[model samples]
Target: MDLGNKLYTLRKQKGISQETAANEIGVSRQTISKWETNSSYPEFDKLVLISKLYDISLDELAGITNINNKEINYIPIKTHYEYISKRKIGNIPLIHINIGRGFYKAKGIIAIGNIAKGLLSIGLLSIGLISLGPIAIGLLSALGGLCIAGVSIGGLSVGIVAIGGFALGIFAIGGFAMGIYSIGGAALASKIAAGGYANAPVAIMQDTENIKTLILNKLPNTPNF
Candidate 1:
C-alpha cells in the first residue's frame, strides 16, 4: 500500500535477497533493509534504480494509481512466451521456442531461444547439428559471429572448411587465413597458398616491394590432383 511495502513486495516477487537488491542498486544491504522497514526513504535516483532492477515502471513501483483508485499492493505479472510442439522424437520435442526478458533455454529437434541446443538451433549461444547464433558450435555447419563446425562461415571461423574475416582450417578463405590450402589478403599454408601476400611451399601471391616470391618445396606428388 505504501512505498516501503511496495519495495518489499516487488523485491520478494522478483526473487532476490535484500543484499542482492542492494548490490544491484549500488547501496548497502542495511540501506535496503532500512528502506523496506520504512526507517529511511530512498532518493529519487535510488528509486529509479530500484524500479529498473525490479523491472517495474516508476508509477507501478510507487503505487501511484490504479483503475479502482485504490492503493495498489500487488506484484506486476511478467510475461514469458514459450512454445513446445506436441510431436516429439524420444524425450525431446520436435520444436521448442522460448522467448522472454530473463534467460531461457530451448532444447528440441528445432530449438530457438536466448540459449538453444537441438538438431537445428538458433539463439544467442547455440549448439547443434546445424547452429545459427552470435556464437555457434555445430557438428555439420555453423553461421555466426564466431563459429566452429565441420564447415563454418562467420567473422572468426574454425572448421575443416572455414570462410570468414579470420579463418583457420584445412581449406580456409578470409582476410587473414591459415590452412593447408589458403586464399586471402594474407595467407599462410603448408601446401598451396594464394593471396595478395601468400607464404607456403607452393605460394601464388602478388609481387610486393622488397618481398620476394618464395617457392620452397615442390607441389605434393599425389595421384589425385
Candidate 2:
C-alpha cells in the first residue's frame, strides 16, 4: 500500500489515536489525518521520526517492495548555504581552514587544537596572553620549549624575569643563567650574582646574608623579602 495507508495501518496496530500520535511528534491532529488520507506528505526528517515511532523500516513505508521493475525517480533537497561554513560560539570564532598548518588558522578568545592563537591559547604551537604549548608565546607569562614574554619559564626562556634550563633576561635563574642578576649552576651577571660557578662584579661564593643584602639593595622597592 501507499505511505498514508501504511501509516494508518501502523498507528492502528499500535492502538494510538491520531491526536496522541500528532502530540507525540509535535504536529496537529489535522496533519496526522492528512497523512492517513494521503492528502499531504511529511518532511524527510519527520518521516524518519514516524518510521521510528511506528517501529517500521523506511523501505517498507515507501512501498518499495510493491513497485517491482518500476524505475524510481529521486529528487535532491535544495539549500542556499555552505555546508562547511565558519561558526562562532559567544564572542569566540571557531574556524578550521584545512590548508598549510590549518590549525594555525584558528583564532579566538580561548582556542585549543594543534595550533591556536587567542587570549588564552593551548596547543602544540600557541600564542596569546597566557599561552601553554610546546612552542608558546605570551605577552605576560609563557611556558613552553622556547618561551618569550615579560616573565617566561620554559626549557629555553628570554624575558625581563626568566626561569628555565637555559635562561637569558634581566633577572635570570636556571641551569645556565645570564643576566644583570643571575643565579644557577653556571651563572653570569653584571652585578651581584650567586651559584655553583658564579661570575659577577660582586660574586658571593657561599654567603647567604651578602646575597640577600645585594638582592635587596638592587631591588630596594621589592616587597616580602
| Global lDDT of model 1 | 0.82
lDDT of each: 0.82, 0.72
lDDT of 1 by residue, 107-136 (tens): 899999899999999999999999999999
- Which candidate comes out best when scored by TM-score? 1
Number of the top lDDT candidate: 1
Candidate 2 TM-score over all chains jointly: 0.51
Show model 1 residue runs off by greater than 4 Å. Answer: 1-75, 207-217, 220-225
Candidate 1 vs. truth: CA RMSD? Answer: 11.3
lDDT per residue (tens digit) for residues 179-198 in model 2: 99898998999975779888
- At residue 84, candidate 2 shows an lDDT of 14
Least accurate stretch of 10 residues (summed lDDT) in model 1?
A: 208-217
